[model samples]
Target: MTSKYEIRLNSKIDIRRIYTNETLPLRKKVLKPFLTEEECINPGDDLTSTYHFGLFQENKLISISTFIQEGHPDFLSTFPYRLRGMATDTEFQGQGLGGILLQHGVEYLRQKECDFLWFNARIKAFPFYEKLGFSYYGPLFDIKDIGPHKVMYKILIPK
Candidate 1:
């Protein structure tokens, strides 16, 4: 069962605090092989970016996600598209936090009238993207210093 965590659209949360939470050890472990220690996007980066959201459990960050407005074709931020960062406390896995975060991201982007929401999902996590209705696109690309990442996108329901 999932604990009570309120997911909201907050652009001011400190990214570092959320990204480094000890509860999400598995998240860190899973993403570690795919991203360098310095390359991981922290909460501060999200707060500073154009669009992002945080999940809180009684004022403490429990999960988080974000997207940046890409002017050209950056992987994380592509021109009004959202590059999603998702994390849940390791203890909270399998309880639906990811799904909640995913839904929240989509809804927030949809409200903003984003043309598309996309991200380079980890190959192992492709099923999660499928469940969210995101279609795989293009050939898989290794994340340079990280593991292979599959580009995925989903059209948002027009507002």
Candidate 2:
């Protein structure tokens, strides 16, 4: 079931204009790990501090990830913590595009001298993040609409 799709590090990507139709498919894919459709959409609607990446197939937007900056406010992180939209089109799942986006984000984070990278990973996806060297911190937290999530973080060793 191979399809013509590609994942690239897109700097010009924007989250704001993504139409619901284009965004919905990826949301469905993420439901396995992130059950809240609204969490996927909220950051896109009002992006205060986030970076964007796009997944495309022949010029069509198929998936997106949003990296939100997080850290102690007084500390003002050199490396921003991120919460990813991490949605892939139903047709594009299991093709390793999510890893591509995550790698790309880490490269950028590395350049910024980030001390840590964190995300609320769904229980099903904990192993995925673990493969990336992110360790779980604290107990799982419940989202009113999305069930439980494990907080995972990777401490970036200085290069």
Candidate 3:
């Protein structure tokens, strides 16, 4: 049996454009608690072409990801977007909120004619990204203070 509270929360999930500052709390809590607030900020976070997205359940921000107009040297696409700092609250981790938010961002980029989307996905997250159609692009590498990661990419067929 579902309670009224559960119904309300399930019915009110929303994904929308958010400011960079709005993503810091979840990112810090879920992705990098060891880093300071300043270190949680990604490069290009303030750029005009950069966008931040958040998923909210009844106004509580639970999932976040940032997209920036950055290209990889190995990829030949003219317009490539990089996904950064994707995180979801611990309580909401397995509910597919992150996938929902990512798909929303992909649709937005497709509308904007982005050629491809890519990111350095953490080792433990490979299966999640793979299930979403992202392919591994490079060999494993490690970021300082962070664990292993691999470049993953998805080609966007423009809508």
Candidate 4:
């Protein structure tokens, strides 16, 4: 029998705010398979100001991302939101689901008058982010078990 998710692949897609827990399965599967379920939870995920976004087709969540109202010391923005645990299911890779979800988050941040959105992006995902207007912020660095990554940011409300 075809799974509900597979059936929804051709259905309408929706992007909206989702709970932090809703983001974990995809985070573990696509972004941190080596980590335990508890380890997949990112810092500040439960904060009141934190926001999680998901792309869903029917009832199936295909892509997920989390944003925290935390600022990097390097960024002088008065209101900076940090992106974390972004993942698109392997079967849904290259479908632009992640980008569409991210853009939706950007619009949400813009509405909140955020100054910028920043994150430590995996080296391989650089082009994906760059295409969406995020610029590299600092030199490449290692995130322990995660390999090479660079700080990337996009200004939402310039100061």
Worst 10 residues of 2 by lDDT: 1-10
Residue pairs clashing in model 1 are 15-43, 15-44, 24-90, 70-77, 70-79
Candidate 1, residues 1-159, lDDT tens digits: the string is 232333333443223223333323333554564545455544444444455455665555666666666532643333356564566666666766667766766776677677667777888778877887888878888976557988888766658
Q: Model 4 off-target regions past 4 Å?
A: 1-11
Error of 1 at 127 (Å): 1.0
lDDT of 4 by residue, 31-144 (tens): 888987678998899998998888887768999989899999987888889999988999988988889888878878887889889999998999999999999987899988
Which candidate tops lDDT? 3
Give me the candidate number with maximum TM-score: 3
Candidate 1, residue 64: the lDDT equals 61
lDDT of 3 by residue, 24-129 (tens): 9988898889988788998899998998888889789999989999999998997899999999999989888899889888988898999999999999899889
Q: Which whole-number lDDT from 0 to 100 does residue 76 have in model 4? A: 88
Query: Tens digits of per-residue lDDT for model 2 on 1-159?
Result: 222222234543322223433454466565543544554464443454455556555566666665667763333446656655666666766776666667666766666677777777888777667777788778888867667897777777545
lDDT: the better of candidates 1 and 4? 4
Ranking by lDDT: 3, 4, 2, 1
lDDT for 51 in candidate 4 is: 88
Model 4 / residue 55 / CA error / Å: 0.4
Give the lDDT of residue 34 in candidate 2. Answer: 50
How do all models score by TM-score? 0.67, 0.67, 0.92, 0.90
RMSD (Å) of each candidate, 1 decimal: 6.7, 6.7, 5.2, 5.2
lDDT of 1: 0.59
- Cα lDDT, all candidates: 0.59, 0.60, 0.88, 0.85
